[model samples]
Target chain A: MTLLITIFAAVICTVIWYKTAPKNEMKVGILCWMYWGASLMWFVDAIIEYAELGAEFFTPETADMINDSYLGLSVVALGLIIWLVILLVSDPKGVVRAALTNKK
Target chain B: MACFLIPAAEAVITTVAAKIIKAKEEKDNGNLSLTDIKTDDTPKLTFSRKLGWLNKLLWGGSALLAFEHIWHGEVVPYFPFLTAVQEGETAAMLAEMGSAGVLMAVLITTVWLGMLGVSYIIEKRPDKASDTAEETQ
Candidate 1:
């Protein structure tokens, strides 16, 4: 269920972003980050849950590898959050202007 | 699963058929004008407007649902069956939490649909007013 919802969200958001976004590179980049970051986070959580459900099927080596990389996902998530914050707060006027001008 | 897989399979077939048709057409016609294929439902975004409370309602609801699942089912189970886990002594707890998650999803979807309806109404209002003004003129 989570996988379905996340995939739907990712595809819809990507299409919406691509269709509606202005020609500005920086703004487009920020929006892409926001969409993909959210999708990535959701995907990871869904995968982890599904993995836990089928843990018996996994080899001990595979389980160990997953456990070792747990912190890496968190780090990436944190970085995305920080990037989102920067996009929201710093030089926000440009974003606001771009958004407003985009209304057709 | 059948409900899910059928549409996905249909989409794949449709896309492949469309590509084949387009390729055959291009081979026969030499060139096709892209502008003739433009869609009318393209999104028009206004930068001056923000989703405001509606955004909060939908996103906040999603966050709440996630929190509810984690806290009640995974972190701390207030009830063994409905809230904690899906089977055995905790089955009831799991069921309850699952119901809550479904409720949250419904609420979020309702709020979004309502917002879309409101936007449509609001956008229509200006056109109506303009029509009236033009009629008066």
Candidate 2:
């Protein structure tokens, strides 16, 4: 469940990053890499668990899947949080810089 | 088992490597300053910055997986830390780590290498653009 969510987010971000490759103000590339890395991590876990649990892996408990989905959402949110911090620190678009300078 | 540990371990190594390389680069190149002059060649991204991308990917991914493991109760706060390891399934855990962990680490590194290659091409674009501009003139 988490794997599905992460993969979806990764794909969406990758498309956006590709479209804005020329002048990427948001640094969507970082977001893309983060999400893709996570997607791969989950993919590997899913494969391994499937190998171990065989058919049982496919039939996860309903409540467990829901909880995993929530965790997936949290992971996406955390990635965005990290990206926000990076943007603030790097200020690639200089929005923060402009605002700070304007205040002075 | 705790396969994510492998990437977590790699994150630690790469983080240290980034710091070391960054220090060396600073000593070699000094501070960066903006200039209005345009030249035949100017790199937009540094080697350290590229490696920083890989480091961030590894660290962020590992942290998320670690959290997931904890959420599933595969990881515990007590000694041994991992429930499987604590249950005396050391052999199985080690096997899983050896196979799955290595594969995951290698897979991520391969992706990062491909990214570096793509970025290299992107970095060369300005030179290509200038060359075309000159040819047009």
Candidate 3:
């Protein structure tokens, strides 16, 4: 489920990034990369778990599914946080700089 | 877990790529001066600038999630470790967390849309006012 959710987010972000393409000012591309990276991580996790549990991995308990969902959400949230930090540091629009200087 | 490394790597790669592209664009446009690129007064509806709402949403949503996790005692006081969700948690607890997660995602996105609307109005206001002033003259 975590893998699925991240993959979904990655797809949506990618589509938005693609539409904008070489003119990305919002840097949605970064978000897309983050989610896709997460999706790949979860994909490997799922594969390993599958190898260990075989067919039983397909029949996860409800609690496990819910746990997976939470994990997925956490990953998505973390990705956003990292992206936000990057955006702030880069200040591509110089909004932060402008605000700082204006206050002086 | 090692999963976190993926996003960390992605962040670095994307940031570098973005910087490169921005530099290339500025060079192509002959705006080689750093100040000219950084201090442009006119908000040229560039793709990155338009994503301001999204950036805000992500920041807000992430902060909210972190707060909620802390409140739930999910975070532990240790280095290189956080969160308590491991194998063999109760089904009810997982369900509750899952539901909350879904709600968070939905609410964040909705709030982002609302912010986008507000920002759109704010962005247009200056232009409208300037046009009005010109007309009055």
Q: Which one wins on DockQ?
A: 2
Count: clashes, candidate 3: 5
Residue-level error in angstroms, candidate 3, position B135: 48
* Residue A45 C-alpha lDDT in model 3: 49
Q: Per-residue CA lDDT of candidate 2, range B13-100, in tens?
A: 9989988877776666655432212345565676677888888788878877887788778899998799997889989888988988
Cα lDDT tens digits for candidate 3, A1-103 = 7778888988988899989987887778778745653444445446657878999998999998898789778767777787788888898889888988895
Which residue pairs in candidate 3 collide? A25-B47, A25-B48, A25-B49, A26-B47, A26-B48
The TM-score ranking, best first, is 2, 3, 1
Give per-model CA RMSD.
Answer: 16.0, 4.1, 13.7
Using DockQ as the measure, name the better of candidate 1 and candidate 2. 2
Model 3 bad stretches (over 4 Å) = B1-137
* Residue range with the least summed lDDT across 10 consecutive positions in model 2 chain A: A29-38
lDDT for predicted candidate 1 compared with the true structure: 0.42
lDDT of 3 by residue, B4-39 (tens): 222333334544655666666667668753322322
In terms of TM-score, how similar is model 3 to the real structure?
A: 0.47
TM-score of 2: 0.76
Considering TM-score, which of the candidate structures 2 and 3 is the better prediction for this target? Answer: 2
C-alpha lDDT of candidate 2 relative to the true structure: 0.83
| Each prediction's TM-score versus the true structure | 0.30, 0.76, 0.47
Clashing pairs in 2: none
